[model samples]
Target: MKKVLVTGASGQLGKCFQKIASEYPEMELRNFNSSELDITDQNRLQQIFSEENPEYCINCAAYTNVEKAEDDEETAFKINAEAVKNLAEVCKNTGTVLIHISTDYVFDGKATNAYRETDVVNPINVYGASKLKGEEYIRQILDQHFIFRTSWLYSEFGHNFFNTILKKAEEGATLNITTSQTGTPTNANDLADFILQLIREENSEFGLYHYSNLGEATWYDFAKAILEFSGKIDQVTLNKSGYYKTRAERPTYSVLDKQKLQETFKKLVLHWRDSLEDLIINRFRKI
Candidate 1:
């Protein structure tokens, strides 16, 4: 049986991957959250890799606090950049295939069209810059690797836009979201499934690929959709407010062009609205 090591096992995407693993009986899955494995601790990570000798390493761990990253630049770089470099180096040495998650923040969001994998990266904030650096390190060190750059991720297991808005709506609090910024809202489960599919196929044609649920919307639109889906549309007051400001600069538009992924995989993710509805029915309805 092939063994797979999943880092950041407690995160939304990590948990989603864990659920996906149940369907594959031939694969042995070992999961590690930050408490179990700190990617920044080089010696510990080296020890684990030597003992476990995983055939594949899925790096889902990251410092993803976009606003906080401005103040915590060092920590952000440590996890998002340096730790990634460490993983890539170790994976390369051990001849292990690496699957690293990245973000759309790598792009400047100036382009009117969707961002392709080949597009020039000009990150406008610390978080984006750090993630981009991680991508560069992986590409340089690991010969067998896949860097999946996704955007606006949400899931049932962790802190995300959907749950946040739903909680606020339940509390009868009005929500003001930015309408200017636009991007595709990706479900973590979909991405996890895609990763497993890639692994099942053992795709050696490794490179950067963009994966996100189909369709695009602004934060304001996303909020409204969530409220409506949660049956809290009446309790929620949707307002377009530029009043909220953060230390980190965000992209006005960061939707990715997934043509390459479609061409390669011969399939595309489900429409965002369809997936959103399914998630609400599956997750929120049970609550």
Candidate 2:
């Protein structure tokens, strides 16, 4: 059986992988949360790599707090950039294929058409810049790596827009979300399944690839869908400013073009709404 080591086990994406791990019984997966293994600690990473010697290392760990990243650029870079560099370096030496999770924020969000994998990156905020730096490190230091740039990730097990919207609707609280900001809402399960596909095939098409649900929606549309899908209707208003203000400026458009991924993986990417419905009904409702 193939051995895979997953970092950031407690994260939404990592948990999603854990949820469906049983389906892939041919692989032995060792999932580790931050507590079990801090990516920032190079010595610990080296120790683990030396001990486990996994054939594949899926790095789901990253600093994802966009708003907080503005104030804590150092910590964000440490986890997002420096830690990723550490992992890439270790993976290079150990001959382990490194699959790193990145974000669409790496792009400036200025493109009218969907951003492609080859699009020039210009991160507008600290979070995006940091993630881009991590990507650079992986590309510069390692050849055996898969960097998946995803956006608007949500899952049942973690704190995400999906659960937040459902909770707000249940409480009958009026909510205001940004209408200008647009991106694809990725169900982590879809991404998890795709990741497993690459590993199962021992896919060595190593490079940066964009992966997200098909189609696009604004934040408001996302909220509306969440409410409707959960069978709840609350006053979910669109707010252009004020209450929705953050320290960093968000990209007006960040829908990724998944042509490269879809073609390479030989899979059809589902529409965002369709995937959202499936997740809410089959997974979220059960919980």
Candidate 3:
């Protein structure tokens, strides 16, 4: 049986991978979060990898606190950049395929069109720069790898936009969301499914790819949709806020062009609204 090891198994995307892994009976799955395996500790990683000898290493671990990354640049780089380099080098030596998760923040949000896989990156914040550096490290050290760049990720297992809006609605609070910023919100489950498909297909020609649900929306639009979907649209008042500037400069328009993925995989995810509804009805309501 082919063995697959997933890092950051406690995260939203990692949980999604765990759920999808159940379908593959012929594949052995090993999962690890920060507590289980600290990628920054080279010796620890070496020991774990030596014992596991995984055929594929899906690296879902990352420092994703966007605003906090500004103050914690050293920690962020350690996880997002340095740790990635370590994993890529180990994967290269062990002849293991590495799947690295990245973000849309890598783009500067200056483009009028959706960013393609080949688009030049110009990160505007520390978090984005660190993730972009991780991508570069993977490219430099590993020959067989898949770098998936996604945006606005949410899931039932982690803190994200959808859960935040839901919490605010529960508190009977009016939320102020930015309408100027636009991008696609990707469900971690959909991304997990895509990763599973890629492994099954075993496409050797590896490179960067973008994955998100079909369509795009502003933060305001997404919040409104979430409220309406959760049957709390009447209670939530939507207000618009300007960019106003902050420690971490966010992209105004980081919508990724997923046509390359659509073309390559021939798989399309549901619209953000539809997926949000499904998540609420199935997962949030149960919790």
Candidate 4:
């Protein structure tokens, strides 16, 4: 079996990997939550690497509080950038292929079309800048790394937009989602599946890639779909507010170009609506 390690196994995307790990029985997975393996603690990381000796290390630990990151810049950089540097250094020494997750926020949201891997990045917020720094560190330190920049990720687990909408609808609450921002709503499960499949195929066409569900929508469009899919459209009041107040500046349009991923893997990218509907009907609703 191919031994693999997952950091930040408690988060939404990490949990998605854990949930589907059993399906890929050829891989032996070692999952570690933040408490178990702090990416910032290089000593602990070294010890874990020595003990596990995993052929692949998927680094999912990150500081994802976009609004709070504005004021807490130090903490965000510590976890997102410095900690990533530590991981990259360790992976380089251990000869472990590192698969790191990044954000589409690296772009300043000024692009008229979808963002390609070669697009010049100009992060407008602290969170985006920190993630970009981490990506840079990985590129400089490790030659065998996969940096996947994804946008508007959501899933059945954790405190994401998808779950928040479901909770509000259950309580019969009114929601004023914004139509100002445009991006793709990526299902975390589909991303996890793609990564595992990449490892399975032993695909070496790695460097940096943009991965997200096909098509794009505004936050309002996403919220409406969530309600519609769950059969709760009429249970709650959903409004189309042109803008929402926020401390951080977000990209107005962050749709990623998936031509590279599609052409490389020769796999189909599911549309956001279809993936959202599948997760709700096949997984979330059952829970």
Candidate 5:
């Protein structure tokens, strides 16, 4: 069995990996939450790398708060950049292939067309800048690495747009989501499945790639889709707003192109609406 180590096991995407780990019997996954594995602590990371000696190390640990990152730049950089540097170093020494999750926020969101992996990066926020720094560190430190830059990720677990909308609808709260930004609403579970596919196939054609659901949508579109898919459209009033006030400025448009991912992996990428519908109908049927 191929052994894999995952960091930030408590986060949404990390939890996605945990939820689907059992399906892949040929792979053995060892998960570590923040408390269990302090990625910022280099000595602890080295020790764990030495002990586990995993063939793959998936770094899901990141400072993802966009607004809060504006005020807490140091903390964001520490976790997103410095800690990632440490992980890359340890992975390099241990001969472990690093699978890192990055953000589409790395782009300035000005491109009228979908962003290619070769596009120039110009991050607009602290969170994006820090994540870009982490990506740079990985590229510099290790060659056997896969950096997947995805957009608008949400899952069944954790505080995300999908859960927020569902909870608000359950409480009969009127929602006014923004239409300012345009990007794909990627299901974290879909991303998790794709990562496992790479590991299972032992994919060697790895470097930088953009991965997201096939189609793109704005926050307003995403909210509407979630409500409609969950059969909660009549439960609450959903309005489209041109603006949503926030501390950190987001991209006006940040849709990522998945042409490289499709051609490289030769895997069918599901549309965002289909994925969301499936999650609502099958996965969240109990709710």
Candidate 6:
């Protein structure tokens, strides 16, 4: 069986991988939380790579706090950029393929059309710049890499936009979520499934890819969907993001073009609303 190593194993995306890993029997999967394996530490990564020699490494570890990253760029860069460089070095030496997760923030959010892999990147925030740096390291350091740039991922396994909205609904609170920023809300489970498909098929058509639920919506639209799904529409009044202040400068539009990934994988995609409904009603049952 092929061995796969998952870094940031305790995070939401990593846990999503763990939740469905059992159904596959052709691969032996091992995950490590930040406590067990800090990606920033090159020595620890070297030791792990020397021992496991994983055939595939899924890097789920990242500093994702968009606003918090503004105040602490050092920690963000360490985890998102320098750490990625270290991991890429090990993966290159060990002959392990790296699957690194990235974000839509790589684009400055001023585009009128969906962003393709070839689109020029201009990160306006620290988180975005840092993630872009990680991608650069992978490209420069390792050729065997698949960099997935996804947007607004949510799952039942961890803290995310969906959960936050659900909590607000439960408390009968009105929310003024951002209507200014627009992007797809991806289901983490769907993303995990796609990753496994790549592994199962051993697909080699690799580089940068965009995989997000089809259709675009602002944060306000997202909030409304969550409230509607939970039958709590009466509890919240969604408003434009301009009413609410955020520390980081978010892109006004950052939806990604999935044509490359869809055509390559020969896979059907889900709409943001459909995936959101499934998660709320089905509680993230495998889909």
Full-model lDDT for every candidate: 0.91, 0.90, 0.89, 0.96, 0.95, 0.92
The total of clashing pairs for model 4 equals 0
Sliding window of 10 residues with minimal summed lDDT for model 6? 236-245
| Candidate 1 structure, TM-score to reference | 0.97
Task: For candidate 6, write residues 201-221 as lDDT tens digits.
Answer: 898887999999999998888
What's the true lDDT of residue 217 in model 4? 98
lDDT of 6 at 200: 89
> What is candidate 5's lDDT per residue for 203-274, written digit by digit as tens?
999799999998889899999999888889999999999989999989999999999989999998999999
Candidate 6 clash pair list: 178-241, 179-241
Poorest stretch of ten by lDDT in candidate 4: 278-287
Model 4 root-mean-square deviation = 1.0
Cα-based lDDT at residue 246, candidate 5: 97
Residue runs of model 3 more than 4 Å from their true location after superposition: 284-287
**Tens-digit lDDT track of model 1 for 122-218:** 9999999999999999998888999999999998888999789988998999778988799999989899988887787778878999999988999
Better of 1 and 2 by lDDT: 1
lDDT of 1: 0.91
Model 5 compared with the native: what TM-score?
0.98
Question: Against the true structure, whose lDDT is highest?
Answer: 4
Task: Give the lDDT of residue 40 in candidate 2.
Answer: 98
Model 5 residue 88 lDDT?
94
Model 6 CA lDDT for position 39 = 94
Residues 107-147, model 4: lDDT tens digits: 99999899999999999999999999999999999999999
Model 5, C-alpha of 86: deviation from truth (Å): 0.7
Off by over 4 Å in 6: 284-287
- lDDT, residue 14, model 6: 96
* Per-candidate clash tally: 0, 0, 0, 0, 0, 2
